[model samples]
Target: MMSFLPQLSLPLPHHCSSSKPFQNPTVIALRSPTTVSNATTDSGIQFRRKLLYLRGLNVNALEALRKNPEFRSTPLRTLKSVETCLASMGIERAALGRIFDMYPQLLTCDPYLDLYPVFGFLLNDVEIPFPDVRTAIIRCPRLLICGVDDQLMPTLWFLRKLGFVGRQAITCQTTVLLVSSVENTLLRKLEYLRSLGLSCSEVANMVLRSPGLLTFSIENNYRPKVEYFLREMKGDIVEIKRFPQYFSFSLERKIKPRHKLLLDHGFSMSLSDMLKVSDGEFNLRLTKLRLRCLEEFPSAEVLLLNNLFLISVLTPKDWKRESSISCFYLYQLPLLDVFVYWLKILGCVNPLIVLDFYTFPILQFSSIIFIFLKCS
Candidate 1:
């Protein structure tokens, strides 16, 4: 067979028969074996790298991380320190998976500063019982994210101020302190309750009883409801102190309707009874006091006060004519007293206030109701 390919032999340069065969530049370069070896090594590395995103980074724990519900999704920037942080805290893999389930974000936090400091504070400063520390962390993970100086210490100090100050105070208060804020929550609620006439001791007892109240907002949750209790509902400080749960009830849903109903019927239900009753019970109590009684059961004469009655409703112009004092000019005691007797047996105060007609206006009616309910 005829060879069609060029040979690597000495066809020698035609012009100079003795000239050595010319070497191809490509072959000459290939002839330097180290270059071929280096090129092969470089290409092999490139191919290997392209096979995997993070080449040469051994993650024997990658399979375990797959079991972590959150760590796999955790941003690399945060995941780098998460396991180390968890391990430094002596958190085993089994427990860490559960922790991540609840607080996946904790995995991304700084292990040394953000993490150990918080753990140290809980274990050392606040002295959260070591056994209970896990439960507390499970309950509230922000201990990892929040700084001890700014967020945590202030809250601890406030909790201490709240009468968690005794030797057992830290143990008693650590859980709730981790859950709330000092400036935004605990402090504001304390100040507002004090403003509501809760004495220092009373406020302390209320907070110790229900730490969640401190989490309620001052402007939205605490203030408006408190104003309604004190100003509109005419509730006594003692009433709420006696029943601190008053802070928990929804104003729109519970307090307003019951209060307005009682006021319109001239009844004065105790604040505790007013807020605590279920809607069904409240409606049942209200139904017993007929709508007709609101307007039709006019105030009878004060003489019949003990008979569960009062005088008929009279216009302001005609009040002087029908006024118990006017009708019974023969009475020794004041008409207000007689009317007070009129509504007491009937379990309402409106008729008495109404009996004064123009004398006792809305605010005055509230005052009389307040004084009467409190005194009663």
Candidate 2:
């Protein structure tokens, strides 16, 4: 049987002791329709009205607007001006959804006053075409937020000094430097480039070629790579000027290993070919080197494994470590039933490819020795 809860009585004032059971006055007050009306504010009501005026925003955007102090307090005239500004620019009605979704502050800020000069300077003063101007503004909405004299002009002048006068596609890569602060990013990076023993003109040329270099950390990326190239690779300032993209590639990953491998093999590859190519392209170049070796030794123990890799990947007992790494990466193996091809290749006695035994990165170098000895 269920235990019944005991009902206790307490004395109450004559006004409160009614026939109906008592409820909390505060609870009743809280649940009132007027209380809800009070909580729903003038700013809140205006925010909803603003949402209605703006086309294509959903419930999620409405919730964001409610919490946004700047957007919530935006004046009617300013909101009207933003709408007018977008219209004056050829920003299609459908595009406003995306534009506003990212930057609601655009609605309050006077775009005609704030943004016009930026567009004007880029298009007319710099002679950046209308299409490029449109692309820069739309692609990076932050372009609207950047000040003309303070942020935008200085960045343009810096880029102009680097010889970027009229060539204005405003690529995603270049736009990053354009929007970044001057004292910290643009000016500081200029100083670091100068420290690399480059004249102002050479530095400007380097910047023009590889705008992304400015973004690299002086300590982490620029200095370490420069030191390695100077001390290890014996590179000169002129050599760095020829290929500033050297700094873009990883020092530990691409530069050090590839340069060492080329020197060891007596194969002289350019900085561009070595650091720039995809893994497949790099392998192809190595295969070409292997073929050159085959010509040097007609009965060479080394075999060319397709046009992508060297025979050492499949043939050499000593190169089992390299072979295992290759097998893991050579994804151009059969799309369907990939592991099955390895079995067929290993079974062949002529030009034996027995290193294909393991699928996972094989640490066991014994496989190579065992296969070769058994074949002999």
- Candidate 2 lDDT by residue in tens digits, 126-231: 5656666656667777877778788877876766666775554345336656777777887788888888888888888888788788788888998899889889
Q: Compared with the true structure, what per-residue lDDT tens digits does model 1 show for residues 347-376?
A: 643333322111122233211111122112
* Whole-model alpha-carbon lDDT for candidate 1: 0.59
RMSD of 1: 17.1
Which regions of candidate 2 deviate over 4 angstroms? Answer: 1-45, 49-68, 75-84, 92-104, 166-177, 180-182, 227-237, 250-268, 295-376
Model 1 TM-score (2 dp): 0.47
Q: 231, model 1: CA deviation in Å?
A: 3.1
Overall lDDT per candidate, in order of appearance = 0.59, 0.63
Evaluate model 2: give its lDDT. 0.63
Estimate the Cα RMSD of every predicted model relative to the unseen true structure.
Answer: 17.1, 15.6
